[model samples]
Target: MEPKHKRRVRYKGTHPKKYNEKYKELNPELYPETIEKVIKKGSTPVGMHLSIMVDEILEFLNIQEGQIGLDCTLGYGGHTLKMLECLNHTGHMYALDIDPIESVKTKERLLNKGYGEDILTIKNCNFKDIDLVSNEAGLFDFVLADLGVSSMQIDNPERGFSYKKEGPLDLRLNPQKGIPAFIKLQELNKNQLEQLFIENSDEPYAKEIAKNIDSYLKSGQLISTTTQLYKIIEKSLSFIPIKERKES
Candidate 1:
């Protein structure tokens, strides 16, 4: 070839990267309608949790500017975010989550949204130890504890919280602290299992389900997954006809 070919130069700043970190915050107009759609559909967007009863919570708390508060279950930081907005970046929020993975991610996300430690402080600890943690952080004006497994935790099969999902039977709120659900199941006797189910969930078929699960454990068939436990429960109740089944 007689003519020399010229190489095209690419500008890094002009060309958008494959992953844009600021897209979520920078594009505010896109989310209002999207969130409304999610609310109407009664489904949370993937990787996001819709704060339950937010208006009620905010009203009850009546968080004023420069007031300190504690959010005991900071699963997806939805409640924390709302509380922070109410505080108007002047007050401090102590957020607690047993899930370390989620806590870190939420902390970083909030920080990216212009909230620093001065505004939001996250603790990777159980709310059961709130007395001790709160003492160190000083007194709080308002405390909100939403005690339940969050949507994010249940949605992720790897965390092993959902009965519908086929995942490990690890239901410990703090995976790092206590024994997994499978081990706990193996340790409990039929009576203990029945009592647990009755007290915790008020399952009508608790006794039968407990007996089946205990038998399975005794037979050396490890009930280590959600589906396995689900099958055991199903088999235990299979004798009852669908027509005869009463809602608990």
Candidate 2:
């Protein structure tokens, strides 16, 4: 029997604006043109990643066949794929990622692309466990650690990495391992919240945002979703003059 064809999802606008609705971005392998479309905007494709600075890193490393390497952050496995090619199938590449959900998908994707377990090994753990990895795999000839949140995480609304989305305010690198961001917000007092915003993000409206959040939490109001937190931030900053808001 033949496979059934699925129709594209409909949206309000001509082009899909919602992350989930962007069929091209959400399925880039099936839409090659979307590659340049996203790259021009300096954004990774949704549902996947295009590793940055590949040439620079490869040139600097000058990897050779038969040499072992470690990719401390697998992400969507883009960088690891390129590095594995430089090994020319003669050596091994080990990678780590904290996100169990995405990492398993990534391992499968890489395998489908002809990089099997013989050449690539993926571990689900924090990179700080390098000591443990080294004890098992021996010292690496070279290492690559991309220290940042993956685009897959940012674009997936369910992960709640972006405040623009309508998901829960999770804000966790590993959703299964940590308390959600909403809980943390509930725990912070106004002054502590102010300092957290200032020290962590340098948010200019730290004082105002913190004051409002503290009041809301104290009043027993809930803020469980990304949209709720975003509204609070907007309400806190509404005191700015419209002209001033546009100017700055």
Candidate 3:
């Protein structure tokens, strides 16, 4: 055997375990379980109520570090935050929403978390006109356009997206942008009503619905609320059972 190796000494630094023990000893009020959870969780995570097929989105986009991502409908910033997590420090997110109130809330929350110019760009504008928005941030490597409404609009009673909710007849994604639902109802002609039924609700008796709506307006009982419109539809087609009617 070669010369016997001399015994080597290993030195260990003062460990986190020792520091934690000392900290607990000094602060008896601290709950160990809570502290452990905090250490594990790091910071509070943001929540979202979108039907974003995240897996599909990522698969199509092929997100990578330092890539730029645009969330056309950044409802509550769910996709934005998720993309940020995957992006490198140099990467950025441009989140857009038509709703001013919702946009403001999302901006404040993102800014509060130390995400500044390097991390995020929030815009309160419609996604349909992509040129106006893209001019600010230029072309993005990944663009996520989640078409249609979000759960928050439906859940929030004030937004009036839900028929069950007793609120104003305002179904606009951006209250300031589009005609209010009630006002839109007033503007619909028989042909327009028939078209709306076919496109949006896919009503089986689209022609019948349009005729009934015209008749109801003629009676001076124009629908102004979801409840009112629902009642009109029910009464107009009372001859048919609701269950047997074609689904939208």
Candidate 4:
């Protein structure tokens, strides 16, 4: 009997790089659908924002035709688009976002889909400034504010929100405004850091972590990236046994 030879199997066609602008531009029609698929599979596309619990949100809002609405965190216009559909050309939707890049793109996308200023208006501002925009645009019958950071923001490494990705330590919702989280960490004293972790995160090891972080900052070992900070956190928790770590 002849010895069987190992055969190498290769897949054809180049796989598109995740979040590649060229891929999105080349496959304009397929891009949005691809984003939906990714979201359904429990993962988010790098630059695409998925609206969560859309049906629930719409049902809860009890949107009616000709009723004005406001979408405070218009991440990628997913919610805004649905609201506009419900409005059915009779009402206007004012969408606000702090992300200049995504906001402009979403506005253009919505406009391309035939939603004009008569029915849709996009504003480049934080929801915290909603009072100003609302006053200018007039009152709204329904308002939606997605308070948490969108998946798009967290997935984009350049925005620096994920510890898994290697990026700057920035955690600001608006990169153009305010100092990044790394700088903020440096500015905070041990007490402030401890208090932040305790109040904001309810971390059990807040005091220990804050002390370590303060020492590192004072010693010029700057935690400038998410990975660096993540490492510090891992190291801080290393003393705990693996079995007990979960409860901690």
Top lDDT hit: 2
Residue-wise C-alpha lDDT for candidate 2, range 117-178, written one tens digit per residue: 99998999999998899999998999998877788788889888887569888988788897
Higher-ranked by lDDT: 1 or 4: 4
lDDT of 1 by residue, 45-158 (tens): 544576789999999999999999999999878899899999998979999998887788778778888889988888888899899887888899999999877766676666
> What C-alpha lDDT values do all the predictions have?
0.81, 0.88, 0.71, 0.82
* Model 2 pairs whose backbones collide: none
Pick by TM-score: 3 or 4, better one: 4
Local error of candidate 3 at residue 247 (angstroms):
6.3
Candidate ordering by lDDT (highest first): 2, 4, 1, 3
Question: Residue 161 lDDT in model 1?
Answer: 83
Give per-residue CA lDDT, model 3, range 195-241, as digits (tens). 99899888778888788888888787756677777777777688787
Cα error, residue 42 of model 3, in Å, equals 26
Q: What is candidate 2's CA lDDT for residue 66?
A: 95
Task: Choose 2 or 3, whichever is better by TM-score.
Answer: 2
Expressed as tens digits, the lDDT of each residue in 1-248 for candidate 4 is 99899653433457543334345532334577876776689976655666889999999999999898999988778899999999888978998888887787788888988898888888888888988987897888999998777766776777788986688998887778899999999889999999999999999999888988888889988899989988888788888898898875
User: How displaced is residue 74 in candidate 4, in Å?
Assistant: 0.5
Compare the candidates by TM-score and give the number of the best one. 2
Q: Could you tell me the lDDT of residue 131 within candidate 3?
A: 86
- Which has the better TM-score: candidate 2, or candidate 4? 2
